[model samples]
Target: MNRSLSIIMPALNMEHLVGEAIATTTRALQRAGLSDYEIIVLVNTSRDGSHDRTDEVVLDLAKKDSHIRPIINHHFKPFGLTYWQGVDLAQKENVMFIPSDDETIEDSMVGIFKDIGQVDLVVPYTVNKKARSFKRRFVSRAFVILCNTLFGLRLRYYNGTCVVPTKLIRKVPMRSGSFAYMVQVLVLLIKSGARYVEVPMGIKPTSATASFKIKSVIEAIHALARLFWDIHIKGVRIKIPF
Candidate 1:
């Protein structure tokens, strides 16, 4: 069957919250006049018992709603590997990536995609409600500017849930070091010219998210390095806002 929508959830140790996330998506789609859709949730290798419980819920949903399919990836932990894997397996024209324990959409988000005609990617803008710290917002804003300046990405928020067209995504080269997979996709897709649109949405960091100070610094350095590398490859001067 030709699916119209495929929502990919890259899950790891989100057993406590995965069920609620999946249920919310299903309801949202239903309210959007979309009863026929596929939900692909990839359960990556996790240290907690989240896998077994999530597997059960996914299978149970799949039984009633044939549109739901649970993809189990035991080889890799929760990172870009599992994320890319989920994207690769998505078979619908419209693909939405929702983090297992992170943010989701509003009623307007449903209307946003329903209104999107031919855009390659639709980025949902994030409103952080969980972490009130200014440090998180600063890191996120700096990276967004760097990506746009270096890779020519016009997205307002790249980390939030994004709705993408499968055909357009297939044209972009997607190969990066396991540790730097997301940066690779961002670089290749923008350099090759992908048309993207942006929308606004709420965001909140889950308690399980790696929001530690050390991790934040490491992530910033890695993103900066990737930005410079892309600039070097293209031989262009990035006009950074800083």
Candidate 2:
């Protein structure tokens, strides 16, 4: 059976929250009258016993619904690799990336399903900014400003969860191993003249441990520099057939 949407959830040390995240996402899809969908949980290597617990939970969920696929990666890879691997495994035409601890707002899910094939990309921005920490909020705002300035596109946010066409996303060559890969994907898509529709969504505050780290920040800066040089200096742009 062909599915309409595939949700790629990357998990690492989210034992306490992943179960609820999966359940809430499932419930949201059902409430939106969307049954033709699959949820792929990519469990990365975790030393905190989260891997075992997530394996158990996802197996139990999969028994109830065959659409839930849990993939365990013994060798830990970067977030981008895990996410794109799940995308490669997706059997649906439309793909969405949702972190294991964060679930998309029900209203936003419904809205995306309503406009599934109407747009090339459905970009969602956080509406409840006060719910996030000051540091997180500030970093997110700064990242958005930086991306817009560098890419010459006026976007409200660059790192939020979005619903994108699988084929179009696959067309964009991804080289970043860091979290900034999402930014690169969005920039390439925008540069390719991909049609976008923004939707307001609510995101829960990420935990400090799961949020930003010094290593990630440095990697992000490196990724941004590479993207700037390739796109602006070398005139590198993805050519989309759509």
Best by lDDT: 2
Query: Which candidate leads in TM-score?
Result: 2
lDDT of each: 0.62, 0.79
Give TM-scores for every candidate, taking all chains together and pairing residue i with residue i: 0.76, 0.90
lDDT by residue for model 1 (56-112), tens: 666676788777789876565536556666677887776777766635654645755
- Regions of candidate 1 where Cα sits further than 4 Å from its true position: 1-3, 47-52, 128-133, 152-154, 177-193, 204-206, 212-242
Model 2 over residues 84-189: C-alpha lDDT tens digits?
A: 8988898888898887885566666666666667778888888898777787789889999988988899888877778887887887776677888888888888
What does the lDDT come to for candidate 2? 0.79
- Lowest lDDT sum, 10 consecutive residues, model 2, at 46-55
Q: Candidate 2 — which residues are off by over 4 angstroms? A: 1-3, 47-52, 205-210
